[model samples]
Each structure stands twice: as structure tokens, then as C-alpha cells.
Target chain A: MNKTIIEIVDSLEVSKVYAELSDPQSGGICVFVGTVREVTQGETVVALEFETYRNMALKEMEKIALEAVEKWQLNKVVIRHAIGAKKVEDPVVVVGASAPHRDACFEACRYLIDTLKERVPIWKKEIFKNKTVWVSAHP
Target chain B: MEILLFGIAKDIVGKSKIQFAAGEGQPTSVKELRQTLESAYPDLGRLSSMAVAVNSEYVRDELILKPGDEIAIIPPVSGG
Candidate 1:
């Protein structure tokens, strides 16, 4: 069976996601990690607080997975996002896709992250040295 | 009368669920609800630039809200 959406936002283990996609039938598996940066918009960010409408966020994520399955002919997919407060260099999001070929895996993984950034309602608050600013939803 | 709140809206409202009364067939646009929310909780008025989404779709201020619609007020995001 093909995997689609796996959503979480706490300290996620990379090995666990890799293990889940290690299938004998799949020829390629691609993974992407989005980390919290120390600076944003030229400001020194101290930390970030991420929040989401949990239930709806999951539903939207699932929809993305289904779309990938149909569009990429993939064997499986996984997406995890961390919620709450996070510091710099922390893994905030992870996405993995497995397909029969490397090209499909790469394409699907990129599409998944890009689409999630545009569609997901998850928001982030940047706590800078001087003040706090809110930014647009990103994956 | 029920609107699903999310993100900062859920935090500011101090609850995830809320009920509002709308006149018969008089759509509750995001703009109208913002005014009502400000009256109910003046503190939220400070966040004047927040956006609204109806039924998981981001919409303009004039979009009419229906009963049982999941309404979300989203602030700007700051994620990587």
C-alpha cells in the first residue's frame, strides 16, 4: 500500500521516517528536512512558535498525500511537522517519498513541500531580538 | 451559529469552539465577525491585520459565512 501523510511537530526521529519508507519494491526514496533558522528577514530570531489547527491541518496533509499518490505513481509518502516552540537548527518539518524510480521520488517530494507551504494554515511567530513578527504560512 | 476557530484565533478566544448568532440568511462576513469579536474582546482589536478562512479556504473580508462553517482567523506565518 502507498503511504501519504504522516503529520507531527515534536522532536521527530529521522531514522523512523527512513525505516518506514525502506521497502524492497521501491527503487528510490527522497527525504527533505526543514530546520528553524537563527535569522529571518535580516532580523536575528531568538526562537519560533508554531501553531496549527491540528485536525484540519492533518486533513489537508492527507489530501496532499492523496494527490501525490495519484500524480506521482508513488509507493509511499510521509510528512511530519513540529508544533510549539523551537530553536535554531531544530528540524521543524520532514517529508519523504518513495517511488519505483528516483525521478518520481524527487519530483513528488519537491511538489509536496511547495504545495504544503502554500496551502497549509500552519503559522509561525518569529521572536526577534527587538520585537516579534508573524510571517506567512510555510511548510 | 457555530464556527471552528484555529491558530491564534483559538488562542485568543481562549477556546477552540464558539457560537455566534446571525440573523436569518444574513451572511456573517469576516469583516462583520471581526467587528463583533473586537466588541466582545477588545484585546483582539490589536491584531487588526489577521486573515480569515472559511471551510479551510482563505477568503476575502466580504465572503459570507454560513452556519456550521469552520471559520479560522490566521495571523501571518513565520515558519521555514
Candidate 2:
């Protein structure tokens, strides 16, 4: 197995991902951090709440990291997510990759975040002033 | 068998876990489990999409259920 860090915590540290993905063999490092935005569409968001199926989410995250490492020849990778309530401007998720070249790191970083959103068993709820809505739960 | 619910599914079911008593006619497959849940809780049926996971991995509806298997309902994911 490669050097991959996958964690789901109550708080997310934006700086930890960069340090975790540092590798002497890597020439480029790319990261994507998702935060709780204050607005969505026309609604003003107060906060965001996240929940996860812990065991499954971790397994899926590890699978995604391993796949990225193999596909992009990455030297190091990290995927971390925050659960519970997050205030606006708080970091919610972070994904990053370090690779031998810029192209690989960039591509893998995109893949890491995108695929994690699609496959991982994590859910986010949007808390507006008047209503709290579960993201993508309905048509 | 017991089915664990998470995300919107948990909200719809109003519980974190659903236990199917053996005498109540247990679902023998993933497809049947989905059907039973949808009928029991119509809200779950109205979701945009959902998936089933067995043993911490996504599985097709045709997968057969076995004793002591870990099953969960995976609603649409929005994590980034």
C-alpha cells in the first residue's frame, strides 16, 4: 500500500493535508478544500451538518485514494472530511495528491475530490435560516 | 437481518437502525430489502437515488443476504 491518509473527524485541519502529502519524490502537490459557504443558490446558509457511515465511508475513501495513486503514479495522497455541525467559512473536506509531475498531481487532485463526492458515503445537510435541507435527497 | 440507515435515509426512517424480526418475514436479497423499506416508508422511495452496501462495500440488488451481514442504505452523497 502507498502512503495514503484517510480520516473522518469532527474538525478538519486545512494545513494537515499539505504536510501529510509532502514527499521528496514528488515535484508537484495539489489540494482542494471544501468549505461551508454562506450562500447557496438564493438562500442564505447558516451552517452545514455532515454525517457518515463511518466504516463504509472509510473503506470507500481508502479505495479512492489507492485508485488515484495507481492511476496517477502519486507519491502521497490524503483525504479528510469533517462531520457534525460546521459554521459558515469552516473547512469541511480536504483532498490532495503529490506526484512526480504537475499534471499528475493536478489531475489526481481533481479526481480525488470529485470521486470522493460521488462514491464516499458521506452526506451534507444545508441549514438555512428557516429550513434545514438534506443535500440532493430529492428531485 | 438489520438494515442501517444513514443520511436522508435515516431521516426518512426516523431511526438509525431497522431490525427485521425473523418471524416478520425477513428480506432474503437486497432488492427485496429495498422493496420492503420503500413500502414501509414511502419517503425512502421518493429519494432522487439510493444505493445498498453490504459488508462495507456497494453491492447490486441481486446480491443475496446472509446471516450477520452488515447492510446499510446509502442515499445520494454530497460530500466534496
Highest TM-score, which number?
A: 2
Worst 10 residues of 1 chain A by lDDT: A130-139
Off by over 4 Å in 2: none
Tens-digit lDDT track of model 1 for A1-139: 5476567666766668878777787999999989888877677889988878776677667888889989998888998888889899888888889999999999999988887776666877778888765564222
How well is each residue in B1-80 modelled by candidate 2, as lDDT tens digits?
78999988998889999999875579999999999999999998899998999999999999999999999999999886
- Chain B of candidate 2 vs. true chain B, TM: 0.95
Clashing pairs in 2: none
In order, what lDDT does every prediction score? Answer: 0.75, 0.92
TM-score of chain A of 1: 0.92
Worst 10 residues of 2 chain A by lDDT: A11-20
DockQ of 1: 0.35
